[model samples]
Target: MSQNAAAATAGPVSPDDVAGLRAAVTGPVLDPADAAYAAECATYNLAQPTAPAVVVGATSAEDVAHAVTFATRHGLAVAVKNAGHQVVPSVGESSLLITTTRLTGVEVDESARTLRVGAGVRWHEALAAAAKAGLAPLAGSTPGVGVVGYTLGGGLSPLLGRAHGYAADHVRWIEVVTADGVIRTVTPDDEPELFWALLGGKGNFGVVTRIEFTAVELTAFYGGGLWFPGEDMAEVLEVWRTWAPALPETASTSFAVQRLPQDDALPAPLRGAFVLHVRFSHLGDAAEAEELLAPLRAAGTPVLDSIAPRPVPDIGAIHVDPVDPLPYVETGFGLREFSVETLAALVEAVGPGSDCPLVTVEVRALGGALDREPGTPNAVPSRGLPYVTFAFGVAAPPDLPFMDEHLAKYAAALSPWTDPRNVVNFIAPDEAVSEAEVRRLYGAERYHRLAAAKRRWDPDNVFRRNHNIRPSSAPAGD
Candidate 1:
């Protein structure tokens, strides 16, 4: 049996084990008793907690390998964290967490139109580097999110997705350290199965050290936010439902039903307000975008209009996601279609008079290139999904019942239109998905393929934390 298989009898992680890891790694290795352990494991979402027996702050791929090898020898499962936006709380699980916050690096090839980033690099860092090269990557809404983790979960760029497809679809290469503690450079041409699986399998396969992906040629785009009064939500949504579907591939849109806090940091109009925020990003000139946006703009007068021509780095302003760590309950899933019925259901669930405690209920239209297959196919299951919905409720662990009740109600309201496929990044940190649900999420064929790859690379399942994709030897459904 593998060392990981014999781990149950290995007892608790000892001080000597932590000391050995600290000596082997170039970065810090802290246990629960260490003074710096909590901060080392800090995540973007303060609500999601972790309790690793030992924390390995990996500075390089070699450090990651050493950590992984040590975890295997000690029979400890490995959990990885970088930006920690999608952290799955350790709770009762005993594992060694590898923190990749120290592996920051960025490089752009203007001639090749590709970018290389360390696993620790955030989207903002990469965006700035690519902006200097007159190019842009397919980054997600929050710039604070780590590039490697997001891309692995099929990075959906609010600005580029409709035209360019998912960030995973454009990936050219991946550098990962597998369960066996060997760092490998993976691509479609080399280690094809591992490449396909890692792009979507997440931490189940191994810890990705670095990645290289293609970037678009353009730098600037016409895009921004438009917030409307909460009372006029139905009216604005009706116009948007029809207007957004007719948009060209060059344009993308989504709307959020926000219950903003009365924070001093917020703008005057949005502070302590319930409003509908419509986000638009178009790869076109101002005149053309304005013409396309006429209907929604004319819908019951917007309270705030910040839409304009902005540089690639300013893309985060479109969603305006919180940068600091805060307690919140978040989850997302795909939608087969957002018909009139779906819109009505949404309005009834979180409209003006509703008592919904969720901070933001968002729906993004997905189609155009997003539905099509890229040159080299990947494991992204949401390809044909017409829409993707994300929602979050501001609440700490003690307030779980309050947040969870409304979240459940909101989900039930849209259950009729819910699709099984979802972006891995958008999954809830606390979600406990069944094996059958996971199979359905990826579809039987794809899940089987991923499981087979996991069997090959990590048969012992050393990396079982996060949204685990088990290295099952049986068939997909079995």
Candidate 2:
């Protein structure tokens, strides 16, 4: 049947369609009744449920191409899932989801100082592989996040970001299966516009199978976190707000106000209590790092201090973000500056005395290398923004009804300092982001270019499961 005819039928997918896909691809095909269907469709963000009509476990680029071609031929939308860390709902009930968990491969070249990683490869695997060669790829705080998805959203690494900018800027090339079902190698020289779109465009244009990027040398850095009593939140944040903007590019830092569950699983100092965590990472010697951090340390007595020299693989320790997947709601906004008033507003909303249900609220300092443009232009937007304020609340079944209002109250409190533009990587799972919001994420010019590229590469809008960029010729509502 032709794609148009198949789409017009609009009934449940038949067994014949699944069988056809299974025959065309080397990987396994899963339907609702399949034994592995649930596991294959599980996502890291439990709040965002995925109920795809079919799931394809893609093992290679050829597998990805086959799946894309099959989906197109069957008139089904395609959604790609790697580590399932994406907060946005990429896969839906009627979609054909391609899971890249089996594409776990990594190659590190010490001589070239570059890492080639498959779509399934997470930061931990890449970090371990690069560590063996005395190098490290720019990765996020959570090591479990898939490298491709994170980098495509303009990965803001916990460390080295102030020195090296975003991970996307370091990308050398990518191998993607576009909507046309062709396996193409994209780079600055090979499909310049597509390459630019892929850099920070998320999964709008195509499905990436593998990515290669320049890795940095030096396997160790001086970094970690300092924990203060909840009563000292004001003092800690004050010191951080003043000290952060003055630091050199070698230093990157963020401060979080966290209310931990009173459970034995947490450390004694942090168990069942609210505390202020001052996380810092410096790409320098211990003495230099200490000198730069002394003022913040002297602000108040710390209950726990873990700052010291550490190997590159231990970079995740800086933020100490939760490694395991759980249900939560996250939201954030960019800030042009963080003044005393902004800090006060934050304290009033989610601070020590506030009856906030949020697990953590943080503001990361942005600037330094992040403000500078890359050698090659990419789609990463709002680089000039100076700070990003984010907060997350652990979702309990009872709280689901009020979670949106609860989170919105806190976000509104910070509105005076918050900018409409936010980092694409930090968009929350439940946020009802619209096309105008997406256009603002990328500036007007970059958005237009991205739309033009989408028109050229995916005019059919087959890859509409992400922070979508509609084709130029499409109607506004379409």
Candidate 3:
């Protein structure tokens, strides 16, 4: 028998009983010898990668359940990773890391317009499946993120969320493994309160194994980016702020300030300089889409323009989020309105005059379809914001102080229109944005109700990671 097997047979499982549990798991139970162990644990931001005691390569839902049960039995903390894109380093040291990179499954129901996806499934997989059935889900700008993780955090898709609300709003059901090692299927119809809390409440309640959500009848869209020189960003942004909210449900847009490396990978005009990109996703006829976007496109000398009808899967090319891993910090706030004054302030903060070599500053317009309340049970409560602003700083060195200063200036500039509350998913792991901020973003009533439900289902606080939902103090024990 292996050392792990011998340890198991010895009996009396202690806090040092991981070797024994490793003996039981069928897949490769890693302990640093695995070459990809370090790389696998490295997240998208690439700043931190916790050294877990054992990395469990889960092959199926049963495998996931086994890993969870084993961790609980052995008194070992556990973390679930899919695509390892967690902006926050939730997975920590000596933990049993359940790597669900193998569960690739998708079942589409055309009549119901829903797709049941495995926890490991990526956006590209779902996008292709939906497109085949003349349907689409609210997917993020990039198609590389895991479906379950993103949806559970309330996915904001590029396909005009204003008309569809959030990706979480469409979820019909979820299969999860609780801390006590029970696999349960939850839906609004079944566990109504649990269902409501898990949608936007993050991974505090349980480990979501599968996701089922609605898809729209969209195969292609009038989507692309129009680039302008740095000098003209001011005029272009002003036009975007004035026109974006007035846009119909068929139109979704954002203004972006980007500094691209002079490389062949980037389009010719966007290379080697600070540029303004007005990204668009329109569902209307080509002629009408052009007519609506003419004012802003006409505002400056066009360096590059690629707005045209394209399949939805290729939408990543527009935002062009870095595919390669690098250290980065993301901080954002929701704006009540992106007025002309607000636009000017933002331009001054991160535009041409700014010293930051930031990857991008984006202002996503969010009123049309996104503002409407969903009839479903979920937790993306910030509906009043006309725009959501984000700053992604990539050039900051390890242990850099300049990053803090840049973010401070950017925050100060937009302070007038900014909401005190911000999304939990966007905050850096190191920064303390405060629970009060989260409550403000989620609202007192919803936060309170979510806390209550969290207590009922996860009173022991076993599943605590991601944007954690703390149990209420009323019930100390179940």
Each prediction's Cα lDDT score? Answer: 0.87, 0.85, 0.73
So what's the TM-score on candidate 2? 0.96
Estimate TM-scores for all models. 0.97, 0.96, 0.91
| Candidate 2 global lDDT | 0.85
Residue pairs of candidate 1 with colliding backbone atoms: none
Error of 1 at 442 (Å): 0.4
202: Cα error in model 1, Å: 1.6
User: Between candidates 2 and 3, which one is better according to TM-score?
Assistant: 2
User: What RMSD does each model have against the real structure?
Assistant: 2.0, 2.0, 4.7
Clash pairs of candidate 2?
262-272
Q: What digit string (tens of lDDT, one per residue) describes model 3 on residues 56-167?
A: 7777767777787776554455677876366534565535687767777989999999999998899989889888898888888888888888887777776758678888
lDDT rank order: 1, 2, 3
RMSD of 1: 2.0
Where in model 3 is the C-alpha error above 4 Å? 1-16, 88-90, 396-400, 421-424, 431-433, 473-478
**lDDT (10s digit) by residue, model 2, range 213-327:** 9999979999999999988899889888889999999999998889988878778999988899999999989999999998998899999999989999998889988866777
